[model samples]
Target chain A: MTEPHDLPSAAELVEAVREFLAHDVLPAVDGRVQFHTRVAVNVLGMVGRELALGPAQAAAHGEGLAALGVSSEAELARIIRQGGADDRMDDIGRFVRATVRAKLEVANPKYLAE
Target chain B: MSDGGRDAEPAALLRSVLDAPIENLRRLSGGASRETWSFDCGGRPLILRRDPPGAPKEGMAVEARLLRAAGACGVPVPEVVAAESSFIVMERVEGETIPRKILRDDAFAAARPALAAQCGTVLAALHRIPVEDFADLPDTDQVAEWRDILDSLGQPHPAFELGLRWLGENRPPRSGTTVVHGDFRNGNLIVGPEGVRAVLDWELAHRGDPLEDLGWLCVKAWRFGVNDKPVGGFGDYDELVGAYEDAGGGHVDRDALMWWQAMGTLKWGIMCIVQGSLHVSGTVRSVELAAIGRRVCENEWDLLDLLPYGRD
Candidate 1:
């Protein structure tokens, strides 16, 4: 049961992870610790962002795409690969937003290392 | 790892300019098309940017040209000191990347408007540069660009296809063209006490519709989780637009900005997919790189929602 307020802000989580790695992880590592640090920090930051809004963002995107006659994640994924949407009469901005939103959902769980 | 082969040329060149001996060199993560490194030369700092192995010979030259163009335009960009086919030596700006810090900090929420406004102003200035100065640069046609990018990836995302078709049918006539910063956003800006110190990574610079830069800044992907606040999650949409207008960017229509924003997200999504494929196929490997590929879906979904046709 994660309450809204209980959830760490993306920045907070990222900072915590960054601090831990710098103080704890780096001192213990042997080869190319700096390289590992950069990778870890970057991934942490990205994960924090995803944790903040990935699910809601994805749902919003899926809804928008569905409105454009795209129903499933798989279908939307295909449309994204093709690089265009079906509807021309509609606003391009709105269509792009929805499409990106849906895609964000797919990446969210992946970011958490799930 | 030490610089092998021609990669050592930048350090050698830089050593000639600086008084100190080169101590250590390490590659910094971020650039996909080029190699970026931070090195110590006689206890002083320097950055080396070079084309990756197997990159075309012309790539470094193009980068130099774009950096020169950006400097002429009054953009806060790194000064290019020297360049060759293998590498370019430049002064590195000191600051945390805007995306790396600003997006996650609630303390910086108040500064969001200011940051976004600054971004707008910077973009407006970048766009004001004369296109003819970079005449040999190729123009990116929206439809053709999308098709080409998708074909290159070989991943059939229906959302992308739909987006391409929708954009083709609904493509707005180009309002005006200028020097476009193809990827202007939070991650690319180096923010310091003096405000945005430098706009780094000009590899994608080109001559195209000015809105391309605007759209890229406002793209949801760059929002870094603060999607509610437009302008790279720093401020409201109106504030950013107003800042650009104040900076002498003439006649910006909100509708036009929105259109560009969607396009920006779509383009980014495709790039992510392509990058992801590269990682998956073993062309490159790294958690961050693979993660970026996974992130493409978010951009695609964002683009889908921004367009009217996708509305319920």
Candidate 2:
């Protein structure tokens, strides 16, 4: 990979803020503010994960879409809606589950394990 | 505080409503669609639920009436003290409604063994109530309604589309309609040390298939990470479904429950989309609401997990 610019990459920057909120801000707050702080931490955590994983996941997604002959999610969704997936149920199911797993990988990976 | 000073103070309004000075009026948390406040009026503990400034304004009366009806039918519920067009005052039932506490804490250990069965019994009792009196609540043909909602959002979620298609193809021959508690789940119930003390949130109460409530409860999201105990993360399906049958909920169809569980999973994902859109649309921007949009994937994964070919 190319180190185009500075010290803190996008993922590192998000991790720093996420850690600050989790360690510094969370302990001091209570109730609604604390809850929102937790959510903010999770949001940043997701951002960090997306930054770190988005490129590889995007490539995998593009491959999966190509295998199914759909250029994009919207296109696949349209096909599924029009009964186009009936002929290729196994492939479509595999693609959809893989796509959802990729999403869960970033949004909340704990759900994937469950 | 975000009402921009246009609305009158909550305390002042409560003072006139109860004919006494309100005391210890503090806002409680966690209802995305409505405001929840805890307070005391003339030495009586109460909770105030009112619509926020620009949100919808007419569910309070409907909810209040449903509470009264449910309470009369032996379904535990908070006693509605008063009901106005935009707000409803009710006695504050003390117990834990948080799923994490109920799922993990030793405080509810004795309560866990019976929680799922209690949910069964409570739902059965509520479903027995006549629905003719409360006929105005929103009713939808679950699969098509949610599909339209996703369509209008204009974002394609193939996982959601698959779930919707499955639901439409395999709907249970419309089970007899009953007064279903639209959002009955672990999070909505006030659980005392002994058992469930009150069932809260009647906003989605409607005349629908009785199995809808049961299936919705079994949705994995409500489990709060306790996936093994499929009945709200506490008990197994045998205890729940058996209790419902034993308690006179009629012949239980196993396949139908699976259908509704998938339907419920799909509905929850779409609701997250709607909730997340509220933040993006600038209607009610908040970190909490925006964060919910990301949680939609959790529901999508669960929906796929429900598919027949799913790998364990």
Which candidate comes out best when scored by lDDT? 2
The regions of model 1 sitting more than 4 angstroms off are A1-114, B1-10, B16-26, B30-32, B39-44, B105-111, B286-288
How many pairs collide in each candidate, listed in order?
72, 0
lDDT of 1 by residue, B5-29 (tens): 2544656556755676776777786
**Inter-residue clash pairs, candidate 2:** none
Q: Kindly report which residue stretches of model 2 are placed more than 4 angstroms away from their true locations once superposed.
A: A1-4, B1-9, B15-21, B30-33, B53-56, B309-312
Native-referenced Cα lDDT, model 1 = 0.70
Q: RMSD of candidate 1 to the true fold?
A: 8.6
Candidate 2 yields a Cα-based lDDT of: 0.86
What's the distance in Å from true for residue B266, model 1?
0.9
Chain B TM-scores, listed for every candidate in order, come to 0.87, 0.91
DockQ (CA atoms), all models: 0.26, 0.66
Q: Assess each prediction's global lDDT (C-alpha) against the native.
A: 0.70, 0.86
Name the candidate that leads on DockQ: 2
